[model samples]
Target: MTPFRTLTAEQIASLEALGNTAEDWSQVRVSEDFQPFQLQQSRLEGEVRIGSEARIIHSRVRNCQIGEGSLIEDVTALECRHRSSFGNGVGVATMNECGGRTVRIFDTMSAQMAYVMALYRHRPQTLAALERMIDRRVEERQSEIGRVGRNCRIVGARFLREVCIGDEVRIDGASLLENATLCDGVEIGVDVKACDLIAAEGARIGNGSTVERCFVGESCILDKGFTAAESLFFANSHCENGEAASIFAGPYTVSHHKSSLLIAGMFSFFNAGSGSNQSNHLFKSGAVHQSVHLRGCKFASGAYIMSPALEGAFTMVMGHHSYHHDTSALPYSYLIEKEGRSHLMPGANLASYGAVRDIEKWPARDHRKLKRDVIDFDEYNPYVTQAMLDAVNILHTLQEQDPDAEVYTYNKTLIRAASLQRGLKLYNKAIVAALGSMLDRGESNPRHNGAGRWIDAAGQYITRQAMREILDAVDRGELTDPTAVDNRFRIFDVHYDDYAHSWALQVYASLLGHTPTVGELNDAIQAGRNAHAALREMTDADRRRDCSLDMAVGYGLDCDNEEDRRRDYFAVRGLK
Candidate 1:
């Protein structure tokens, strides 16, 4: 594959001038401008190939293919013993680790996929089919040699084995890396030790971090001595100074504290505070307990959760709790500990401007350098809103089942009658807010698109009917692989709102026991507009208060009196 050629006497003379030696000159293939003097004390062994401009590769280069203009310096060894697909078809032993459920990882694997794999074990044949596809992909790339791409730099990296380095990657002071695939623009910094990793473009791991059998998605960073094992992190994830095991981090999930232990959980768009922790083992025999802390959940400092718990999206945990609660129906609530029991405060985050600010900041914080691998976008998009609608519908069913139940307890989480009523109101408002968001963004009619059951195709929000048609084609062998599925998933992030509106209106109409006509859609649009106007007014008022003189009291310098300080603050504030 390298366009190998035997070394002639003149070519040998040219190589010798560079002061490098190959165990078998015939196995070493170089371009026309090959210079042996450029390589010093480097042993090229077992079919090593160097491009035209690469120089000073390593102490030992075994079965490696170096691309043009790459620089490798101060590395102890680079070896590839066997052909590996990096993280393709990587089956991570989660939960018990005695091998109950193995989450298979692929390059295009999304956090949604990992979540389904961990929780939806009832669909065995489907998971097996997905795993088989990944296996086929791994077998397709049957090559033993490692690779260093063009314009890449490896400095002070002590050991690398069976790794496929993409173009323009930077590995500096990394101790060891094995069976990894690094995409373009990736950087592995000081004392990083990784095994079985797939780092997409703009992914960075540094500051004494250690990763084992992890899928570090595009633009994800694990720094400041973070330790992770068997974790799957998607685009724009960040973790530092903590430990994560058997975790699934979706886009924009961040935990930046030393004592954070995010283990055996599924998370996305989430944040963990300092000393936040969770146990996969509920004092069980074999650490078999698992949990689902869904997207946009946050934790206060020193907070602890005992799993097998399921806390819903945007829920905030504020204290230590050993109760295995399922607050999946109570999104954007606070789960606190009162008298060693779980106390639920519903819709509390709705009052916090911080939650709104977090949603605003996620889309703006995308750091992915590779556009191809970035799957999730618009962190608080309509996809999440659809999920909330689904949750609200489930709550409705529960209420219908027990008309007079006082304190409804489902899955260890207690919900008072007042809280349930308030939650339904809040959930309705949230949906209205979502619909209003769609309407304000020029969607005058909600029934314009996505007019069917929306199916979650591993993170791709698509119409279920269309997915059924695609899967039917796959069954017929008309589509050999899942190309159609991937193409449908490859749609841009902009369409999420349109699709969500169509689906939300349908769901809203269903709750009312009727199909939504154009008039209903228009009415929903009007409601949405009203909600938007109110939100704008509230946010503007809040911003005004934030810039007021009360907030600027300590910063006004050279002010002789309170009035002068207030005037100076107003001058800087430029408040109307």
Candidate 2:
């Protein structure tokens, strides 16, 4: 341990002059950089320990351990009632707020892990073991002194209790923050009230937001007085002026504008327009309803859906929907309410130009600059492809089982026979698009061979087979800690391409219904790549059409002639 500088009697007198008092004078640990002139009207109580270059003005702290270069100004109170791991192992009741639906919030909680915890309740022993592991972590984090990390600023805060603050954090104008763990580079801004939260690195919570039992992932923003409860928002999610409950929001889930309530839904790569909402209650006794909004879904303004509905990937919903629909086999389509009935438009979103840009721009939009591990951004992976494969199977089964039915209705969702056929084509197109990318990579590098079932545990994509190997080792006492499950996530976090190719290979096998020889795989790969290249060309043409001279006819008001118009178009569009 580094030695602490002993202050002179004159320094003690100077500290007394500043109206600063400590419960135990011997417990006060200052450094050579410490200056008495910097502290003013601050009270340190109950085993409080402070670090060098600290500026404490108009604040009172009890059992707090403040780090070097920290600034605590105009803070009402900072205290710890008891030993806490902040958010770890704290049970949150989601969906039915009743018993048996409690999920443990840990620092390592990811959307994929939470998915397993929430949906895999059928595996009691496995869940119990995971919960026990988290509880052990909670116990291990117990400390008498609440910690404030280095270079952090705690200004104008109402109250902070048992919170583990991280390096370079800023918590200003927060009403009440208790039992929360803030990782490095987190910013909690004005009028924020939170409890039992674990905000990952570069996460921001501000603008009068009220949050409880929430895990805000890296670079996520919850601002503009948004209210959230029992939600697990993953990387780069942004929610403002909306209410969310029991939402397992995955990467890039954005809901802005007022009166938007996302409740009891599992979503990823989602975008919600103004007044977008979901009804989880059936006007019944218990709110046990939940839904899954698969990858790249969007909801138009004033859109609503009654839950227990499972929507497919990249699907769009519009208008108020009282009738629940399970459109799990229909990707790149619209589920619209027409005259109080639902209508499905197949292969519509595939033509959307925005869809191409949305996927391309996600990597650039990441706000987490300090840490890369805390942020997850992937275009093609097992999670989405797995869903697509499942959708393909569903469509195939539906068509084969009811060959004669003109209209098919199952699980409250309706699909026309003709539309079903179109949906299959669209889904296959999507799969082929992914397969093309994977094959191009594989062809470019023949030495690498990645094959298997990928599991999305947190943001990491690991082969289920690899995970089982680790778990088997754990069961044999080769791996002692249950947190070894985290290793599976870490593997994919670093080696994403391996997992990607693995999933691609597995999906290819499933599509053909048998394993192909290397030569056969190559032939299929080339054909898919050729088709995908044509598709990409078409998409590029569509993109150009938006900014082309034809689309900019009204923009060049000052143009004299066709030449001037061409010049103006080039100037504004900035492309050939």
Candidate 3:
């Protein structure tokens, strides 16, 4: 820390002449190279320390330490009344609004940490240990004086109290920001009203949004009048013109529609279409129920569901559903309401062009400067393959039980006979293709052991045993803080490919009932290639529907002839 010197007699006179007033001249301190002329029409009170080249113009700064090259211009009031942690230790009641699921928000909180905190209540001792680690992190942030870091520009802001601004941040035209930690490189834009919030590095909270008790992750964007309270939003999430309450939104969760309300749910890699909604209260009890939509799930326009439900990965939900079905064992499927009944088309999304597009685009769309959360972008990882494996067996059993039935019921969702047959084949094909891809990686030996149940931790795929070991380390008092836990997660990320290979080998051995010979392995590889080609062909055909003649109806509205319409349509929607 650079030493601060009391303002000189001449410097005080110069500041007074420029309409700057200090409560006590002795209490005001400045850096060795501080320029008195830089401050204009500002009131400094209660131990203000100004760094070199920092300018406080037309602002009221109280009990604050302004860093080098920082400009606090055209502000109303900036004050720290008491010792503040700047939104650290603020508990966000995520997943359950009425209580029972709350995550402590801190400056360095990652998605994986929050995931364990909110969802691992079954392990009470582990949750207690994790909470202690977070408490220690929050204690480190407590300070009597608020700080504005180097090169930050807070312009046209009104009423900022107990806010800790980090390096290179830009706060413009914000209104009533209180008790918030704006991390390094954060941008707070026009008319944002935030309280008890932690905006992580490279995050932007702008466009008249209202956020309270929220932990905005790195590179996440919340804008366009988005209102959120008691929510935990993770890396790369984008929300605009929507409302989110009590939601544990994992990485890449997006809700852009004006009429969407995502509440009391755990979601990751999800997209909420226009008017998407979910109800957690059935009126029998206070709002206590919660829902889970796994990775790559999408809710179509006007989609609604009651809580106490679980959706599978890459499942597309449409219409209203209140039956509270669990489709977790059926990945890449469609759950749509047809004729007032829930219809489940298991593994139907495998042939969807949109599903393939989503998997391809997530990695490219990540905007985080430092990706602390580990993300496995493989669409057919061990977690998803396990779901597919279960789906195949379930389909086979259903077919055997009712050979002539037109519709089969499972988990209160109806599946047509033809849809079941097609889904079984699709699931089998996907399993073979995924196994072949894993075999081609050439991993003879793996470092991390992957056995037992697999889970998708936000975006990363890992064995449940590995997650439990991390918790055990925490409970044993070895991993003392959040940083130590993050380092372990990083190590897991580094060895992800090797772990996946080991798990795939186990799956292969289980299928063959013994170690595969060289000839058998070669045959399996060829069969996987064929299945992959077939699945790809189906998705390609689905893509062709985008350029069909019916879809081009609005493209050439003013065209007089069919030839002119064709030319215009081809110009806008080119054949790709």
Best by TM-score: 3
Candidate 2 lDDT, 317-385, residue by residue in tens? 988776677776566777877778777765556666667677777778877664333234555556666
- Give the winner by TM-score: 2 or 3: 3
Compared with the true structure, all predictions reach lDDT values of 0.73, 0.75, 0.91
Position 196, candidate 2: lDDT: 90
Q: Rank the candidates by TM-score, best first.
A: 3, 2, 1
Report how far off residue 330 is in candidate 1 (Å): 2.2
Tens-digit lDDT track for model 3 on 1-576? 867998889999999999999888898889999888889999998989998899999999999999999999999988888999999999999999986899989998888888889889999998888888878878889988999999999999999999999999999999988999999999999999999999999999999999999999999999999999999998999999999999999999999999899999999999999999999999998899999999999999999999989999999999999999899999999999999888999999999999999999999999888887778898757899889999999999999998999999999799999999999988999999888776655465655777678898877787898898898999899998898988888788787777777777788989999988778777777777888898899999998886777787777789889988888888888753
Give residue 538's lDDT in candidate 3 (0 to 100).
93
Q: TM-score of predicted model 2?
A: 0.86
RMSD of 2: 3.9
Residue-pair clashes per candidate: 5, 1, 0
User: Is 1 or 3 the stronger prediction by lDDT?
Assistant: 3
lDDT for residue 508 in candidate 1, whole number 0-100: 65
Off by over 4 Å in 2: 5-8, 23-26, 369-411, 416-424, 442-483, 492-519, 541-576
**Tens digit per residue, CA lDDT, model 1, 1-576:** 345456678767766666667778888878766766657767778988888778874477888888888888878888788777765666776543445667766655555446546655775655566566667777765488888999999988898988889899999999999878888889999999998788877899998999998888888899999999988788888999999988767777789999899887777778999999988664557677777776678989988988778886679998877778887766778887767777776665655566677778876887765444324433324555666676677667768889898867666666667877777766667667766555444342444366665543334455655545544544454544444445544552346556655656555676669976777777877886676556546555666677766698675698788878887777777864
What is the alpha-carbon lDDT of model 2 when measured against the actual structure? 0.75
State the lDDT at 466 in candidate 1: 51
